[model samples]
Target: MRLAYVHILPLEYYPPATNAIRIFASMDDVDAAVWTSANRKSLPEFNCDGVRIHRLPFVNPGTSAFLRFYQCLKWHWDCAIALRKFKPDAILYIEPHSAIAAWIYYRLLGGKARLFIHHHEYYAPHDYDRPGMKLVKLGQKAEQSELFPRAEWISQTNESRSGFLAKDNPEIAAEKFQIWPNYPPLSWNRKSTQPAINGPVRLLYLGSASFHDTYIRELVEWVARFPDKATLTISGFNVDPAVWEWLEKENFPNVQTFPQGWQYDELPERLHNYDVGLILYRGNTLNFVYNAPNKLFEYWAAGLEVWYPQEMKQITHLQEATTQAPLRRLDFNELPTEGPFPRPAALREFRSDYSCENAIAPLLRAFDL
Candidate 1:
């Protein structure tokens, strides 16, 4: 099987896309290729871990709504042209926009390719009510009316999000919807034998940071309140400018920031040092309320305890199901005020139950690979 994975963003920046491409390419019966775009001046075509990668020319839609709309159309055209040339047996659309492009390729251009869709975020119709999102809203409408019914498989990160998607599109068959959580590859799993902490607990937040509608500010303040008992590290590629400005002005002694975050490959070694991993989404939207991000499994793979918001129904269900990692729920209103923070004993050993290899088993069975 020749499989093409289409995503509108840089593949290296999105671990989920990279993970899927790698897994598909590694299969004995499948030949995988990635069709993606980057804003850089030059990105040569390359092969990564058995998968061929093709980088399409991309225009950075800097803050301008017109440019953003133009860029979206350009990407759809590029993707359709590339898919027509590749003529893959199956195409995995990384998001709705990519699926829209695939729909154009097969429906309008008379291409023959089985369509599969994987959504990283759940967007309700109301989510695109902004003026700049007219194109996106139309694309989503097409996805529901055309792509969803036509797709052989459609997946979300968790059951809760999948339920939301199904609820929104009742015309689609139930068996077409599947769950593919964001789990790290088994190679990234680490066995940590660190003894119980005799010093301040090392807490880490290792993803995008945004103050608006997120608990980032509250988390930082809470960590700062117990500087003598805990130390916090904020690191990611998408850390907001305001976060850095506030950090510089406040100058919290125990807090550390890594604006230039570590590469995805370095996570196993780098994350093993942290005692706890934080998920700080405030659940402001239904999409967020059912959040089950890759960080949760990555934390478990690295032998770190997972801490997430109480309102994240997906994470709460996962915590209840898994005994391999210590998962805790945080209530921002009732935070501990004193020291001697409770830490689990030696970190649990790496468990196969939490690996990407395990998570993708159902997907493989569904694909009949």
Candidate 2:
């Protein structure tokens, strides 16, 4: 079987995405290709395990939101041309931009391949909920055009999100939607639950710092208050300069910032250096409440106890999954003060059901692989 996989989002960082690596690995026995893009500032080509990658051409001279959108549209057209040339039997695309782009291409320019989509975020009817606004109306129309009953296969990051989508759009069959949580890769499956030393408890906060999760700012504030008790290390790309500037100016002895993040392969080892993994989001929006985060499992895989918001609907499964990796709710008043920390054996057991291999099993079966 010939297969085509397309992802319009930037894949500039490492460890390579779980889906990307899985697709490429599977390519060895079948005729397959992957189409993706990178920031213009980075190298234009990538090769993984003998699988060929086609990087879409997208040149954005400025960082403005409008320019980025325009560039992505151009990338979409470039992908469409490549899709026609490759003409595989089936195509799998990632959330938001890639899926929309592929659907547009298929609708405007004919294609016979069956199309599948994965939703990392539960994109509910935000604009449609408030239809009077001009931009909201446009947003609603665009979303409807791309994601409806037509998708051959649908996967979501968590059960709550999938259930929400199925309930919202009853026309789509319940069987069509599969729960594909943000499971970690095999490399992160290391389990070593040595207690976080009695000194300062090391904490990690990775990914975007500016977005929701006002609790992160609160964490920083808490660290500022008790500089000797715990140290927070912030890493990842696109962090707000102001946030970093404030941290630097304060020069809090306990807080450390590494704006340049470690490579993806380095995550497992890197995570072991810290005592706690933090994935906190303000559950103001339904998406936030229902979303499944990648960092949640990444921390557990590396055997670090997790601190997440109690309000998130997905917390139930995470709490139920492990005993060795103590799941702590984000507490403003204090950090984990007492431990002989739980050994990582239970978290390692939780890893069994939540790896890329298990997450993509249904997809492989549906594709008849």
Q: For model 1, how big is the CA root-mean-square deviation?
A: 2.4
The residue-by-residue lDDT of candidate 1 on 1-369, one tens digit each, is 888888876776678777777788778898888878763423233347887787776666564767867777888887888889888988888776566678789778887788888888998868878666676677787788777877899999888889889988888999999988888998877667677687899999998878875688888888888878899998887778898899889999989998877778779888878888899888889888888888888888878887888878878887778755578888865676674275767456545356677887887776668
lDDT of all predictions: 0.80, 0.67
Which window of 10 residues has the lowest lDDT sum in candidate 1?
38-47
TM-score of 1: 0.93
Please list all clashing residue pairs in model 1, or write none if there are none. Answer: none
Candidate 2 regions exceeding 4 Å error are: 13-19, 40-46, 59-70, 127-147, 193-196, 320-325, 331-353
